[model samples]
Target chain A: MDYGEADRILTLLTREMGRISARAPGARRSQKRFAGRLDRFALVAVRLSGPPHRLTLLEAELEEPFLGLRDRLESSAAAAYVVEVSAALSPEGEAQPRIFGLVLEALAHLAEADGPPSPDLLRAFELKALDAAGLMPALDACAACGGPLAGEGIGFSPAGGGAVCPDHAAADPAASPLSPADVHHLRALARAPLGEPRADVGRAAHRRQASALRTFLDAQLGRRPRSAAFLEQVMET
Target chain B: MAEADPIRRLIHQLSRLPGVGEKTATRLAFHLLRADRAICLDLARALEEVSAQVGLCGRCANLAAIDPCPTCRDERRTDDTICVVERPQDQWALERAPEYRGRFHVLHGALDPLSGIGPEQLQIASLLHRLAPAAVREVILATNPTVEGEATALYLARLLKPLGVKVTRIAQGVALGSEIEYADQGTLSRALAHRHDFG
Candidate 1:
């Protein structure tokens, strides 16, 4: 975020630090210190100083800039959404090599993608991130009861923590209708490797899956990410 | 205290400006009080006049006293080429250089999705409206070389390319008077990647 005049308040997610916000003085105006190394989604190795309460960025070297992501709008928006989600899921000052690797892989895939990425890519990233954070929603069994989730009228409840059978669906008013196909797709996404390509799930199913994950994420984060809405706008346009 | 005293109120307002702390604001307030009355009065009048008269230009989003900004209204500049910039300050910086004589279109800001800044929040619709007449033959994207600025430029390029207009981005490289050895790695890498043959 832009701070007073030439300064910038940077929120960085690292493998060692997890997530930390630091003050970079003269980052906006001066070219010598930061020098385009602080671009969003760019992996940088930074040297920080000062007390633990308030760390100041002294130097930063760009590791993987992922410059290809800036070549198109869809890719850029997707990258932003991924980074926002990763940062939100990560805790402050904790080691999160898994999540850091997941984010780096996702961004690298998007950067090297042939065209605008499919919505499934985002869904896959969401599932993987949730898994990395140990918050993966209950997909195989009912969230309310450890019973099998089968039959029509199955609901996915963010409040109930995942897939809810028809019997427990009435308990949560916020539960949205989830089809068997969507449940299977979510399960497959959760289990699939990050680099593997998946078939398109069609537009309607994509919307349903995106909405389900969005509600689940909102419940986890306590609020929707601003970039999610922007991503929707860009995709629609 | 600020509500009761004009001096305190002035200091409070000045302190809200970027980079100005309460101490600096107080110092400035006392300095203004000790200075000539005409100088202080002139400064106040200038501020009031600017705040009252300066509004965004309808043609290009730059702040201007008139409907169309002076740059947009100038007959000497060509209408076929429009230089797109992120802010009015960027437009002014380009104006300092005498090489380009094209008109300008200001987007006010770039696309920063994380900050909730998207195409709808900017003057993108106005820019597209200006291009609908088919008068502009080329659009020079002069947005900053930052990530957000690059995203904005690329987003505009994607949208403008479908409209059949020639779209181009400003060159990125090392700054003049800067040593190559002292330049940062990212800048040097980009400079090398975008290198051209010398005359």
Candidate 2:
């Protein structure tokens, strides 16, 4: 975010420190200090001073600019959504090597992907990020009863934090019906490596999975990410 | 009450401006107090006139006192070209150079997905509508050199190219009077990639 005058308030998702906001004074005007390295999706090695919560960005060296992400609108939008979600999932002033790796892998995949990025790529990132945060929805068994999930009448509940069987579905009004096929797809997405393509599913199945992920994210984050709306707009166009 | 005091109220209002702290606001208030009464009254009148009259131009979305704005209504400017910028300030900066005599379109902001700004949030539809007249032969995207600005330019180019109208982006290179040794890597790389035969 742009701060007072030429300063910038940067939200950096670092491998060592997780997510941190540092004040980059004169970042907007002086490229000498920042060397034009503080752009979105650009990995940088930064030097900082001051206290932990109030760190001042002294200098930054651009490592991976991820320049290919700027080639297509879809790629850029996807990269934006991924970065925003990763920053949200990461805690402040803590090491989150897994989440950081997930984000970096996702960005690299998006940048190097041949065509329009698959929806599955983002789904995989979300699953991995949730897992890193210890909030991955239970898929193997019923979240409430911890029993085996039934083939029929299965629903995913954001509140319950996993797949709910028909017996527990009625208790949570917020639970959305999850078809067996959708569950299988979600499981596959959770297991698939980031950027790896999965079996192409029907549009309806994709919509359902997207909604489930959105609801789960909203429940966890207390609100939907702002970039998610932008992603939708970009994808629609 | 402290809120009821005129001097305190003036200081508070001044502090609301960007980059002005309370201490600076206090200094400004006292400076105005010692200034000529005519200057203070003129400043007040200017502020009131701006607040009451200034608004976005309906055609181009640039801030102006008139609906189509003076530039849009000017006959001297050609209808063959329209220069698009991210803000009114950018348009003003381009206007400082007298070489170009063309109309302008201001999107008000660049695409910033993280900030929730998208194509719908900008004045893109209006720009497309303006292009439908077939009078515009070319559109020059003059957004900033930032990543968001570059994305906005790319998006606009994709949308505008199919209309059969020519779309071009402003060139990026090292600034005039700046030493190449002192230039940043990004600027130097862009300059090298876009180098042309010297006259």
Candidate 3:
């Protein structure tokens, strides 16, 4: 969530960019000049000194941070989880701007009331994260036959990372099935604008996608994020 | 992230704390190792006890040994006043304030339709059961000020209103050390609504 506070510098690492820390001084503490600027959702402007070779510090700005996420614990938790992933996956002094942008986009969706970071917002984030990590699940062709995908969701392995058509699913009765709906839904969330959606039906559909993504990601990660338990304690009834 | 050693192993475990990282974890682990034997023993005993004895309270689902818990069993506290919260921490926070003298109900969690957590996942059934039997008057929802908290409060408010319980929200405000000058619109509004009479 980035919008108002333009001064605090956050060290962000993307799979693309080497470790990059940008400064938006007074982001959390400053107001008025950057009132409601550094929101927890969308992207914002940040100026940072690149490591070693790049001597001059340059000002960097973003489209926005997911702006509307402060009030809901679900959205907040999902967004926090994304940030945590970003922090963990990327190493020091490596900048991956594409992955950074992906995370920023995810944060923006999380900030919206109808954002993808709902209690079940797990799937979308996971899919996007995996994709950014070049860990995209096999959805297009069958993992077995390499044929085109069929149906709403296809049986797949989290270990393999994509859709396993019904025949392959039948062959491997115990294999994890990737929902086609879920895959496309995550793709949509990755591309959609970071604001409250106008329709409940669309939101509901997205929510379902997020839920499926959660299962898929947890399966892929094998280990859930430690924050998942605490965040669940706060959200689940 | 370094060569393995006893010191490093301890640091690794220490880093598991919610917010701790490599540096802080290293510092704390070393601190514990260097401390008095008795201190270490005390911690070991505490850990063992928590694992062995601590469990959810039967009445409130809070962590306690007793079945009904002291709070639930106390006769002096108003049984009619029920303070509802999402966790034991929230209940503790309310108890820390002297202004509230009512009894409490820990939901254990709020309503999060996502993550497959629904109404059945919570202690709502227990809460609903407690209502008709107890001489409860007001139900104060003390969930966090976050959106999920509000959504939960509102949902419960609707549910309990039909039961004839006076459901209320714990107003949001600038916390004790919060600067009034820097407070936002929503917080200010909440603070004003729940203003206490100092006189």
Per-candidate Cα lDDT values, in order, are 0.88, 0.86, 0.62
For each candidate, give its TM-score against the true structure: 0.93, 0.91, 0.52
Give all candidate RMSDs, comma-separated: 2.2, 2.5, 9.5
The local lDDT score (0 to 100) that residue A86 gets in candidate 2 is: 87
For model 2, what is the alpha-carbon lDDT of residue A63? Answer: 77
Backbone clash total, candidate 1: 0
Per-candidate clashes, comma-separated = 0, 0, 55
Q: Look at candidate 1 and tell me the lDDT of residue B140.
A: 98
Q: What is the interface RMSD of candidate 3, in Å?
A: 10.2
Please estimate how well model 3 matches the true structure, expressed as its whole-model Cα lDDT: 0.62
lDDT of 3 by residue, B1-199 (tens): 6648877877776676654657778778878888998997898799888888877777667777676888888887888888889998888878999888888888878754334345567777778888887489899988866545665775577579999889887766677776788664545655786688796
**Which scores higher on DockQ, 1 or 3?**
1
Minimal lDDT window, size 10, model 1 chain A: A28-37
A11-130 per-residue lDDT for model 1 (tens digits): 999888889889999997786678778888888989999875598999888888887787778888999999998989998888789999999999999989888877888888998998
Error of 2 at B29 (Å): 2.9
Which of 1 and 2 is the better model by lDDT?
A: 1
Residues A1-237 of candidate 2 have per-residue lDDT tens digits of 777657889989998898999999988677577866887898888999998899999988877777768767788888888998888988898889999999889999988887767778877888888999989998888899988776777888999997888888778899888887787788888887876767799777777788888888889988898889867766767
